[model samples]
Target: MVYPPYLQRSWQRSHNLTNAQQEALEMAVSEAERMTHILQNLLDLTRASHSMMPLQSESLILNDVVADIAEMTKKFEHRVIHLEVAPFPVRVKVDRNQLMQALSHLIGNAVKYSNADELVSLQLTQADSWAVIQVSDKGDGIPLCDQSRIFEPLYRVDPFGARSTGEAGLGLSIVKHLVESMGGKVII
Candidate 1:
């Protein structure tokens, strides 16, 4: 995340620049933010794989977790994202923070890849002994060939696709690691 002070400094300086200069500065700032996001995701993947991050497992109601994530999604997405869950309670044993991170990765990807008008849905259902949380998007799905490689760190469906978003392809890898660390499996 970009620091507030940095943002403050940037905003304070932006007033002095010409229109073209200000636009350039804004683009630079966005690139820096995307780089920061990539680096953080890399660090998270490393920490998760090496057992450096602690897992604080608890018996959490699946509905509550989904609600919390839905709220966060609404805030981050700044739009009307969709949520569908069973009316009844569904409980699961997992690390709330870790699970939240994983689900956020999934939902965040949904929002990032899809268009503004498209619906990104987070659906929760209980299947036998397991609780399933599915994030579905209307974006063009990943290429068949790329699907298998997506879980690999630094792998992108189309490498040139990063030109627009500056994504370093660490999201899915971190999600996979985080979910597995909590004894839960991630399905693409």
Candidate 2:
């Protein structure tokens, strides 16, 4: 439920603007669909975490999920995301939306943290019985010491100061819970 640092900064920056300017700024902020998407994701993750089991389970194609996430993230002008999907459909039995949520969080994080004009890649393939999806970024990689606990709820790596990347720190924790609840595993 925490707003990203960018949004907060924007609000602060607009506090002294004229009425017309403030209204226009608010409208522009409202027009950005990413906030709505992130809020919905948070709500969905909350519901899933509290439920005994995921609500829906079915066979799904992971490539489609990756493509969808890429499409959404392409809206960010600063990010360059690349998709290397396998020729065949990478299918798995799971809740489509849940998996999409997990993948979206990971891919979104990659795009958010990546250096300007750098590429973020989504690679998908099958490994044994598990469908493997890897989202990689070429930005400042996670530090070795903090890697082990990044999945903990509300544990921000750069918590003491301003965050260059706008994240609420709940995304990865939610992904980990959702993946584990479905009897699958997520690696950092």
Candidate 3:
């Protein structure tokens, strides 16, 4: 979707519009982007569930993958995303796009639940045989009763949760499927 940049260009080119008109356009654009995000999530969930998501596996630099995603997510503008990873290339075999989607979902989750001024951290570290990517936030932790159900399709932690903030509950399910399909483990 041509979201922010289009909205931005419109704003820059619009000099005659009143403040209220400008605000209305901005809000409409925001809503469009939100709907696009939700629709994409639903499609991804369907693909993941049906085992129809294709994998184009390649050797990828882990740091590059995470850094690129972090850069793109900076446009969110609501939460502070702190990405901590070494500049040295850490290599892994996986479908890069799928992995990016999974990581994006994790980062999005952290950003959504955490307060606007709070920090959301994404840390990457390598163990002997596995790469660990941890996403943490300062928000209230998930309830013990809901922890096991969080990755299930259509399951929401709190009804008034992040989905209310513009995401559908399909994200974690898509994340789980994508990671597992790429032969990696997802630990919440």
* Candidate topping lDDT: 1
Model 1: lDDT of residue 15: 88
lDDT agreement with native, every candidate: 0.87, 0.76, 0.83
Highest TM-score model number: 1
lDDT of 2 by residue, 83-161 (tens): 8888988887887777877887888778767776898888888887778888998978889999998888767788863
lDDT of 1 by residue, 23-126 (tens): 98788778778878888898999999898889898999999899899899899788567889988899988888889899888988888899888888889999
TM-score of 3: 0.78
Clashes of each: 0, 0, 0
Backbone clash tally (model 3): 0
Task: State the local distance difference test value for candidate 1.
Answer: 0.87
Worst 10 residues of 3 by lDDT: 159-168
Candidate 2 whole-model C-alpha lDDT, 0 to 1: 0.76
Candidate 1 RMSD computed on C-alpha atoms after optimal superposition onto the true structure? 2.3
